[model samples]
Target chain A: GAGVSQSPSNKVTEKGKDVELRCDPISGHTALYWYRQRLGQGLEFLIYFQGNSAPDKSGLPSDRFSAERTGESVSTLTIQRTQQEDSAVYLCASSFSVFSTYEQYFGPGTRLTVT
Target chain B: AQTVTQSQPEMSVQEAETVTLSCTYDTSENNYYLFWYKQPPSRQMILVIRQEAYKQQNATENRFSVNFQKAAKSFSLKISDSQLGDTAMYFCASTLQGAQKLVFGQGTRLTINP
Candidate 1:
């Protein structure tokens, strides 16, 4: 079975620029999530989508960060006016469902460097 | 708010030996799930093991196992017969029942030596 996949394994951008990270979840997955991981740090939750319900944006650090998932397939995380502080690895994960028992399969991640 | 803590920043184990990584969490929620995820140099998070808060019996998967202590809010992962391929960063995470988001701990880097 195909696992989760992310595009632009590495991205370098200038401060204040906007970047979009893409994620393709495994087939049939109904839940997708985005997280950020700074160097040598833990993962920080960004946003989550379950089916067609309103995405959970509670973890979005600021309004500049947003994500959208079309139906139950692909998800894109957009960071508008990116700051140097936003430099980190953006990870995407998906599970069969939103249940706690279901394990989320992660992507390779996109390392965004804001210079 | 739920929080996870991994005390050890790094650890090492010889091949065929056993090693245990400690993890603790803080949360008022009674029912939740605990997980251990391994991230190799390739940077993909892989599920190592998982434990349900309500389950009294610990969870074990082949050479990987977990010691779940609900009262202490502790979940430790024990790897037996560690292999070189086991070298990676291990993260402890927790999520409330029916929740889609996971709270993760600062990972512990485990190196398996031959």
Candidate 2:
């Protein structure tokens, strides 16, 4: 329970359906990140949230992909009209707010399977 | 853009022995961080070790240590006295200054044989 927690350990969804993955980062961690790991591929950056700083949206793959965080706690990645190729393990990580370190604590990612 | 590469796709080591996993990266910045993460069957991504690019001394944590070659841009992880519990997927990652994006390698599948 102390580590970052993700909901729906596994999700099977129909193509063109909407799917929302929830991530509950460790308490007091100001920086939260979203990453996607496709089968046989490395993790790809998605979105980031820092306390009060504008969320970095550069890593977002497309306009259809969006995320939001409520007061630096629970964050959700919403995939609208999910496609089959969108299947992957979505990972969420959080780190203490430090200017010089990038050591992030990760969660057991949610495995999404779009059929 | 920075990228991490793990050349060894799969590695095997005898129980109680030592093995090293190789990782390389391409970066222009002088200051950054390199990390090795382990994902076991439980699927929890655990930080094995971390190294700051500017530090010359190697970072060590119990049985895990890292060999960092700054000029060569290589960061390798060495696991000593490997146990069955050490079998897992190991990922090498890098991140830059003033950013939260972590670039990761494809990961190496490690197995410890008894």
Per-candidate Cα lDDT values, in order, are 0.96, 0.91
Model 1 spans with C-alpha error above 4 angstroms: none
In terms of lDDT, the poorest run of 10 residues in model 1 chain B is B46-55
> For model 1, how does the per-residue alpha-carbon lDDT over B44-111 read when each residue is reduced to its tens digit?
99998888898999999999999898999999999999999999999999999999899999999999
RMSD (Å) of each candidate, 1 decimal = 0.7, 1.2
Give the DockQ-based CAPRI class for model 1: high
Reference-based TM-score of each model: 0.98, 0.97
RMSD of 1: 0.7
Per-prediction DockQ, in order? 0.94, 0.68
Using lDDT as the measure, the top candidate is 1
Model 1 reproduces what portion of true contacts?
A: 0.98
TM-scores for chain A, candidates in order? 0.99, 0.95
Which window of ten consecutive residues has the lowest lDDT sum in model 1 chain A? A96-105
lDDT of 1 at B20: 98
lDDT of 2 by residue, B1-114 (tens): 899999999999899999999999999998899989998977788989988887999999999999999999999999999999999999999988776788999999999999
Write one digit per residue (lDDT tens) for candidate 1, span A1-115: 9999999999999999999999999999999999999999999999999999999899999999999999999999999999999999999999999888899999999999999
